[model samples]
Target: MREFDYERAADAAHAVATVHADPDAVFLGAGTNLVDHLKLGITAPGRLVDVSRLPFDEVTERPDGTVRVGAAVRNADLAAHPLIRARYPMLSAALLAGASPQLRNLATTGGNLLQRTRCVYFQDPTVPCNKREPGSGCSAIGGFDREHAVLGASPECIATHPSDMAVAMAALGATVRVLGADGEREIPVVDLHRLPGTAPERDTVLHHGDLITAVDLPALGWATRSTYRKVRDRASYAFALVSVAAALDLDDGVVRDARIAFGGVAHKPWRAFAAEDALRGAAATEENFGAAADAELAAARPQRQNAFKIPLARAVLVATLRDLAGQEAR
Candidate 1:
């Protein structure tokens, strides 16, 4: 690892200002991802601004029934919080499904969102990865692509975002609050992550000096009936091959509303807007659900080894919606 200077940020403003002052400075939250990158020689920032001690660690309930989760709130604490377990069961379940107990205990909300992809090529500094080194070309595109993305993937990159919490947030319609050098601003969770277009290096829309303050989850009564389903290579401590976070509101066997997001499938949490659009006002049946899932995966372009992901994603979506419908029926 490269030697670097360290600075302890007193608060969010100080963190932002400190990063703004140094072009190569990076804010350190839980240090789970940053530390790993440093050891792997993936990132060697000149200065490390520790923001874990900042005031952004509280989980508060708003007057309007919305939940405000500070960026530094630990994943385990967020999952076990009474309000989160009671109201946002999907979010809680998503958090529990990720990593292990020890890592979740140390991983913060913002840090989890900012976590990098687990692509082998990207992790190996010797290999060429567009996300790691721009214009160097993406080795995953023609290499071992079983874990790569099928949706929203450009020819330059096919890496998938690895975050269970992000999929839940995308489905729940959460908002991200950030403190930048200019001031504060809010970004929707769906818009927070960027698709791998011509510029595949940029994972998110955050500015250089932006410090995430909190995540605001709006009141969604239907989320009480939501669930998260993940399929992976292993039973535990494995990233999703294709995961679904779904919330459905049914009225007498007809869909009233729906929120769906898929993980391990795209550059970001892949929001199934087309599927949701097809599900709304449609009969809550397996056939209808299959059609909706098909509509969403219609644009999926899979590689040779990972072509099975398209069918797997479709089945997962159908099964998840069917299971939710059964729950609603009961």
Candidate 2:
């Protein structure tokens, strides 16, 4: 809708250099969310550096049994990959549970992680949003906050980070390989997103001119047995009210290890570290699951309309943990 220049990146170096040179430039991968943002006036990049055809679309498995997904790999292709479907069913499930098939066919791995929030105020230009325009003040604090955050929220803003893949990736302990103007660096998936403390505008730790090259997931034994459960008002094409991605390793009905990450509840993926600590070495029983869910939700500080999210998160976690434990939900 707006006038903009575009070019296909010749290589990674040229792309990074171009971005560094022009602060008004943005790398274009899938263009699903970025294009929409552009049309909505949420973002206006003077130049679009297309990197979708940069020869980084492969998904490879390493000798150590870990998997490395190219940044430009399509969500549909990645989800349908035989190795990913068989090894990381939870990821596939969460991917399929997201936007429609057509969108998934165009969405890329890096773009999905960089996707913006779905907060209504942030999308509308008339509404004052700190994320969209810093120092403009956040209108969601006292207005239409039913879908706002409950945990990891600040007085400045109460928006939630919307990414189903990021939640599953967090549980998998995935690492992102970034190639920036400063060279290469790996960022843990958990540390990728930032909390909305005083600065709610910065959603991630990514620096300017940094291009995410790939995502590396460590070899996890629970990948096959993992489950991702998302609850929403409507089943199809709906964002999660509270979603849970969980994987476990138990010995003789006793929990040996647990990985839990929550979506649609916080600024970043809620890992439930305290809950995992409580579940470790504990019996895989209904009582233990309840205790773990409670421990995780104990820190929840909900607003008027969003107070239900705490119970919703708890119920989802309990049922999801039971599903992972091969127990019937109550």
Best model per lDDT: 1
Clash count for candidate 2 is 0
Query: Per-residue CA lDDT of candidate 2, range 126-205, in tens?
Result: 88999998889989988998888889999888998888888999988999999999999999999999988888889999
| TM-score of candidate 2 against the unseen true structure | 0.98
**Candidate 1, residue 195: CA error in Å?**
0.8
Off by over 4 Å in 1: 327-330
lDDT of 1 by residue, 1-330 (tens): 578999898878888998998999999889988899999999999999999998888999999989999999999999999989888888999999999999999999999998889999999999999999999999997789999999999999999999999999999999999999999999999999999898988999999999999999989988898889999999889999999999999999999999999999999999999999999999999889989999999999998789999999998988899888884322
Off by over 4 Å in 2: none
Clashing residue pair totals per candidate (backbone < 3 A)? 0, 0
Q: Check candidate 2 and list the clashing pairs.
A: none
lDDT over C-alpha atoms for residue 189 of model 2: 94
